[model samples]
Target: MPEMGRLPAGTMGLAFEEAIRRLELRNRLAALFERWGYLPAATPIVDFYDVYREWVNPQHVYRFTDREGDLVVLRSDATLFLARLLGLQLSEISQPLRLWYAEETISHIPSNHPVGDTGFQAGAEYIGLPQGEADWEVIILASEALECLGLQDYRIHLGSRALARVLIEAEGQTWSKDLIRDIHRLSGPCWENLSANLRHQFQCIGEPDQIAQQLGPFASCPEAAFLLQSCDILRSAGLGERLVIDLNEVGLLSYYTGLVFKIYVPGYHEAVVSGGRYDGLLKKFGIEAPSVGFSLQQGLIEVLHGSPEPQAPPAAASGTSWLERLANARRRRAKGERVVL
Candidate 1:
């Protein structure tokens, strides 16, 4: 039998100092999001499994029968839940909604990494904005968030789903999940069979201007044109050196209809942040609007940055009597100095 107090394989328990640091980090991120005009949004931790049945893989989520005999699941994806919620209230809310959330999502899949199934995500969603404007805003926000965490050595791998489709169609090949996966892997037999030009296109990864010059023939296509335009926008905003244009780096989600990106810091195997523009996702809930967002894994961030320095407790109030000490403590607290009696 397992030890009495043992936690599950993919779960985590934080000690006092680490827990305090986590709270501090969450508050700092919340303040950053608020300063950017993103209001906090939350959803139920559990929902009917049917809601996400079509979008997520069964092996990736945790589900069980509820007290009422209905299949329910612990929330696996914050964006999906937020999209479903916003879709139901689209008529009730104003356009260009900016919402942020900090929550923990649990998954069934086990992982060897320190950041496992129960991941804490801090993210923001921009709803009802067109492609270029919305994508630019979210990408800049993501970059700023990394800077807030003191992560200077990071690269944002940018790509476009539409551009991927265009490239595949241009080569007289049908766009399928398998082909996209193979291209992303970049070393499979399917990748080897690809034409030299297409393989070169997938291999092209560099700064925006370099990529634009390299793929001059494909630049005229609408998808590639828009991607380069967005690149120019980011370059103008002083994020040129931080970008890596990878045409094969399409997002993991099928809902992504346009720009997709992942932020990677040096020495980390997994992306610290990932998201994209998913224009068609909200439509599934009967709302028609474009949405873009990104989520950062807080656990991975804590590991990267290390625990913050712990604050020293305030000195205890001195008094002869218990009542006097209590009064002194209250006075110090009122003056904004934390005191113990």
Candidate 2:
């Protein structure tokens, strides 16, 4: 029988070897981000409820009232918090600052969902950069990170919120919050009826050039023209095969101002990686810089990449007892050499 206070569902406790592997993976990812000039950063785990409510679904956040009676939440996403943390200092920094982060985020899933309550996310933000190359840089970095984790069968699905919104606005429809929400959910009769023709074009996902050819007729639409041009650029950079353009795909976060993407592997239905450009988010934080970034779920990597390779057992000292080995280990530690007893 299970104990009265057994570990909760949708949570996990990793053992020694697995824990070490996770640590090593994090170290390698941090090293990679540093090599790309993204300085490491961290933010408080808990933030004001309003911060998350503005950008994400409030129901998914773990919330509580502090002693002062102000509502707070366990952060569901780091990108928004990062913006809030650094926004005030934008005037003091050089243009195009790159920031990287590795942290645990909490989400309260519905009872029927199989997702975990906690997950580790690693990501980077390129601030003060514009849409084209900066967006490509973040997407390529995300793909590279997935490759580093041995997930070769993954595909990146790309979309543009700015394009979608422009198309809707072109129809002269009044901006409807409910309609936007329906679009993101990709469901409901409203979106289905309104997005009929656009959905057909959006579903034409394939190599960038091929999609561009199909979208060329709509070149009169500035957003479509930009999207088509971006596609050619991505193809020139050799990402045509690995990328899928989904015009109907909507941004997961309300703040995603421009291009947005999600990474999907063969076996997992959910995105293992997600990110986008949010040029307008900084303005909300009292800053006016554009930014782009992505978050990789470490837990998903562990699941998809499988267990790390086994390491050989440490050799025992030929002429020393356990006590002598401990003493030797202490001596080595004193000399700055790492020793495992």
Candidate 3:
């Protein structure tokens, strides 16, 4: 029998200092989003299993049957749940809907990942906007969020779902959905019979424009063309230095229909933030509109930000009366500071 009161594997409990730092990161990111006009929103922790299965692997979700005998799951992904919550309402709404969320997510995490089964996530979604301004805005906001969290030395790897598709087709190779799913992972089978030049291109990372130019004939594909255009626009907007072209970074979600990207910093093997445009996702819910967004995982941010410094304890009261000491402590606590009697 399983041990009682023992937390499951791949899960953790954050203590005082770690919990405080996590909250501080969340509040700062949320404040940044609000400053950009992305209003706050939330979704239920538990949602219909079907709502996520299309985008998330079934094994990665915590599933159970509801009282009605229908399938339900603890939310493994916030984007899908948020999409389901706002799909119908957004159909009648105008374009350029901006929203942000900070919440906890639960899932069956991989054994090798150095994180718990549950984690705090903070992110923003830009809905109803197309590639040009919306894409640039999201990238800028991502970099800005990292900087606000005191992460200055970070890299953003910009990939293209469109370009990846074109590259596969250009190789005259047919890939099953399962194969495409495993292509970027370590356990996946390698693509055999590929040319040396093709293999090199797959591993290539450089300026977006340089990669686009090197594509030569494959540049004619519509997806490649769109990627080239967007890259140019993003560079012209002054994000050129922080950005790099990475064709091999596939998104976890199959619905990522356009540009996809991830943010990495020193010392972390996994991405700190991941987001992209999914113009096709809203339509999956019967709502036809373009959408883009990014999520910053607090676990990774804490890794980069390190532990919070201990605050100095409140000075001892002198000859003040008991009532005065109590009132003084109350005043300090009211202003969101720690206090001691």
Candidate 4:
């Protein structure tokens, strides 16, 4: 039997100081996102399993039959639920919805997985805008969010599913999830048998100009053209040194139809943020709007930021009554200061 007070296998509990730091980090990111005009949004923690069964692997979802005899799942992916919610309820809203969410997602993981199943994600979604500016905005916002978190040395690994698809078709090989994953990891037994040109294409990674030169004839492809344009835009916006165009790193999500990216910090081996364009994801829920977004892994951020020192409450106002002190504390809090009554 499990120990009485022990948490579940893939769950974790944060103590007071760590929890407070996490809350502060969320608040900082929230302020940054709000400044960029993203309104807060949320979805139910429990949702119909049928909605996501097609996109998600069954083994990775925590599902059970509800009282209504319908299978349901603890939210495994926030973007999936948001796509359904926006499609079903807010479809008639004006075009180009800018929304953000900070929610906990629970999923089942194999024993070897590094992190727990329950994860907190803070993200922003830009829907309805066409690929160009929308892509630039989210990618830049992601960089700003990292800066807000005091992470100065980081890099964004940018890739495009569209470009990958075009390249695969050119080589006469059909694209599959397994193939994409293998390419992303640069592994698998099939790697030895791939054509030399295909192998060289996958090896193409560097600054935008270097990638364009290496792409040779493939650079003229529409998808590749868009990607190069995006790189130029990002460079113009002062992200030139930080951007790395890596064609081999295609998106992990099945719905990603355009550019995909992952942000990495120095000490971390996994991505701190993962997202990209999923123009077709909304169509799965009966809406047909272009969409792109990125989700920041709060746990990973916390690990990178380390445990923050507990804030000391403001000093008590001298010669003030209890009521006056309370009022002053309230005012300080309103101005975003830590206070204790």
TM-score for each candidate, following the candidate numbering:
0.92, 0.88, 0.89, 0.90
Count of backbone clashes for each model? 0, 0, 0, 0
Model 2 ranges with Cα > 4 A deviation: 1-4, 88-93, 175-177, 213-217, 307-313, 317-323, 330-340
lDDT of each: 0.85, 0.78, 0.79, 0.86
Give the distance in Å from residue 126's predicted Cα in candidate 1 to where it truly belongs. Answer: 0.7
Q: Arrange candidates, best TM-score first.
A: 1, 4, 3, 2
Q: What's the lDDT for candidate 4?
A: 0.86
**Which candidate's TM-score is highest?**
1
Model 1 over residues 254-292: C-alpha lDDT tens digits? 778899999999998789999999988888887878889
**Residues forming the 10-long window of minimal summed lDDT in candidate 1:** 86-95
True lDDT of residue 172, candidate 1: 83
lDDT (Cα, tens digit) per residue for candidate 2, span 143-203: 8888777778878788887877776776665445566677766666656766566656655
Runs in model 1 deviating more than 4 A are 1-3, 92-94, 187-193
* Per-residue lDDT over 70-126 for candidate 4, one digit per residue giving the tens place of the 0 to 100 score: 999998889999999987886554578899998898999787988789889989999
Off by over 4 Å in 4: 1-3, 189-193, 311-341
Q: What's the lDDT of the predicted structure labeled candidate 1?
A: 0.85
Q: Candidate 2 or 3, higher lDDT?
A: 3
| Candidate 3: clashing residue pairs, number | 0
